[model samples]
Target: MPGSEAIRELVAACVGKVGGPLVALRKIVSAHGHIDDEHVGIVADVFNLSLADVRGIVSFYSDFRTTPRGRRHIRICQAEACQAVGSRRLTREVAEALGVELGATSEDLGVSLEAVYCLGLCASGPCATVDERVVVRVTREELLR
Candidate 1:
């Protein structure tokens, strides 16, 4: 979590900018890892939006998390291109190997498994990312390691 002062500064910096609320929220998530209730309130207040409006934005975007993710985040591409190339099977295998379901963090908090739409590597379908590093034609073995 960032200090209140830092959060305030982040929100203040986006004031009056186009899409300031979304930008501020992204900055908060980038700096603090997640958007908590307090952060929601601060962003709403800073942007003059209703609390519901702010919360709606957070919930609508899969990129925004209300809680912290694990130390290692693994995102498997599930776009039609990837799915056509066996991303579903790959997803299942990775989840089974990691003992964590998609959109969930492991009990030990060491890894979080998530599904994303695409990685812009459609030619190399069934791609995934480990800690933000793209892996084309990723295997369960590679993800587990």
Candidate 2:
């Protein structure tokens, strides 16, 4: 865990950087609960990024955290390109097998499931990323397999 003081300092920075309701929710949950969401609203308000801009940023980048992430983030590509192969089935299987929602991680701290438009590995057709690292081909079995 990040040191409390360090976390507090970061939180202060975040507050200064982002004073929106979404950011406030992030702070509240960070100080209280163990999870939060990818706060697009907060990011927009903080940077004065437009809603469209924020949505684009959030949608284009899978690395941004809207909520508190689990130990690991499992990002699957649901873009037309990836799905053209078999990413759709793979996504459903991962979510179902993990017993969690698309944006949720398992209770075991093993993985969190998410959908991405493209992983920039279009050649791979069916690609996914793990924690902003390890872009690789994925199948339903391979995901939970």
Candidate 3:
């Protein structure tokens, strides 16, 4: 959401002089919570990348977001192991409880739900990561907590 000059300065600060588009994008996302269209332009100009290039990289990565995210981010594992443990049901129930579908943020900005393929905790599946902390064997009650 920063202006061109501000974004340039921010990227420059992070990269010193020659900034990488991917790295600058990460910086913007970390600082601003998401990258808007304006940010994509700034990143493209500053990194000598095309707008399409920036958009492609952003969309390809699960970590990047085109819009603002909620204060708390929730990622549920949907891998085979997690699915075997009822992650699909868990995802639906959590979505219903939060009133937001997968890959959506609540209107109140409390939480954003995303489906992740794996968390490496498959053995303890139905795993979830809340605000970046992995929670194993997650349940609806645990999500509400």
Please report the candidate that would top TM-score against the real structure: 1
Worst 10 contiguous positions by lDDT, candidate 3:
11-20
Better of 1 and 3 by lDDT: 1
Worst 10 residues of 2 by lDDT: 32-41
User: lDDT tens digits, residues 20-51, model 2?
Assistant: 43453355345533322334444455556676
Relative to the unseen true structure, what is the C-alpha lDDT of residue 145 in candidate 3, on a scale of 0 to 100? 81
Rank the models by lDDT, top first.
1, 3, 2
**Candidate 3 displacement at residue 28 in angstroms:** 0.9
- Cα lDDT, model 1, residue 38: 90
- Model 1 segments more than 4 A misplaced: none
Q: Could you tell me how far off, in angstroms, the CA of residue 94 lies in candidate 2 after the best superposition?
A: 1.2
How big is the positional error of residue 41 in model 2, measured in Å on the Cα after superposition? 12
Ranking by TM-score: 1, 3, 2
User: Candidate 3: which stretches are off by over 4 Å?
Assistant: 1-4, 14-19
Q: Give the candidate number with the greatest lDDT.
A: 1
How well does candidate 3 score on lDDT at residue 63? 88
lDDT: the better of candidates 2 and 3? 3
lDDT (CA) per prediction: 0.91, 0.63, 0.85
